[model samples]
Target: MTVSSSTECVIVKYEGRIATVMLNRPAVLNALDEATLKELLYKLKEVAGSAVDVVVLCGNGRGFSAGGDIKSMLSSSDESKFLPIMNTISELVVTLYTMPKLVISAIHGPTAGLGLSLALAADYVIADTSSVIAMNFIGIALIPDGGGHFFLQNRVGTTAAKQIIWEGKRMTADEALKAGVVDEVVAQDFPKAVREKAEAWLQKPIKAMVQTKQILCEGNKQSLLQVLELEKEGQFRMRATADHKEGIAAFLEKRIPVFQGK
Candidate 1:
């Protein structure tokens, strides 16, 4: 069943116990603009309250997502416009992370910046071999938001997480898997692999699995919340930086950015 119309930025389809939530702005590589983020949050809440046992988060078109909309960022010059966007992202991340059902991120092509954070929120992440993953906010003189700090630290520990964030390097699927950034990497037939994995999960005692997830997530919930708050404030600071202005200018000009320690 179709939960969202084609015109929506996010679309939801249900089949049996599985609900697939797809990011729908293929023209711009599904970049998360304010409307897209809000629609996603609403759809997630709807799915969370439904009878579905599993949620598969994926993107339509060439790539999973390129991250936040750079165009939107350019437009949000003031706190009044920016903070609401960040808050929506925070709420969406929290909802996905705390979802009662099993959540799987089916990643393909470029998944960077805030997109990586959203993918990490899932209980399991399956990446196609073509996928390139990055915590790339540093390149834009910004920091990762959407609980990136908490999730990256949880997956690869603090030291590696900090290094990855600072470098903002892109990693291939195998590299990401080796670094413990992704759960599984599929070289071929990515969609089939995701389906098989989800079906296999369905065969297990899913309720008990969800219970364990709830316990662990609940126990560490405060840490994630704290990180989100820090990211929100830090992002605002970064937005005001000279380096950030240079980064945006360089991006628009399709050139390299020269950042000065300001």
Candidate 2:
């Protein structure tokens, strides 16, 4: 696949069997605005049902992602406006979680808030010595969304996941590895190391990987129809929140959000 750039913030590059999804906004530390999310979603859909053997998700500039674009959120805070943005985020996370292909995240630098959910959805998460992972939702007076509440609890147990979100503590790469959130901690030249690992995964039959992923994901599955209803209910509830307004507003203003949790 010949990878092309829809814009500077996103680039899709394919070499041999590995498709690389790079977050290109290094200047802003790859902070994800609405456009970035849209581009990413479009790119992901582009690769859907393709013959790509493996997918590598990484950031271009300083880190993987600094989380959602605060400026973008704060500027669009009416519940009506905010709900769609949140919907987009929710869909992205769910898509990544259930993706048929092997998704690997090469995380370096800061991955915060919604970005953390993105990292957690990947099949394998590899971080460098300098990487940082944080929930940081409480820092802005918001509860964890974007499936962080569900994914983190599943990975690290409910009690610990609650503590992490409540405290909004940012974990270093080593700390994340110790907590089992990340699969491996590499040395300084971590990107290359992660690429090597991704390349290796590409050599195997994708069906085997997909089957293993299905089993792991299925272990906790409820009736499929029930789960879909649950997700719809969540969307309905979040749409009624005052904090959603604040979150979107503060993001657009590039200022700290004052979430009243109404």
Top candidate on lDDT is: 1
Tally clashing residue pairs in candidate 2.
13
Tell me the RMSD of model 2 versus the true structure: 4.1
Question: What is the Cα-based lDDT of residue 232 in candidate 2?
Answer: 45
lDDT of 1 by residue, 96-206 (tens): 999999999999999999999999999999999999899999988999999998999999999999999999999999999999999999988889999999999999999
- Per-candidate TM vs. native? 0.97, 0.83
Give the top-scoring candidate (TM-score).
Answer: 1
lDDT of every predicted structure (CA atoms): 0.93, 0.76
Q: Write the per-residue lDDT of candidate 2 for residues 176-234, one digit (tens) a residue.
A: 88887788999767867987898788677878888988887676444332433454466
Model 1: how far residue 119 lies from native, Å: 0.2
Which ranges in model 2 have alpha carbons more than 4 Å from their true place?
A: 1-6, 218-262
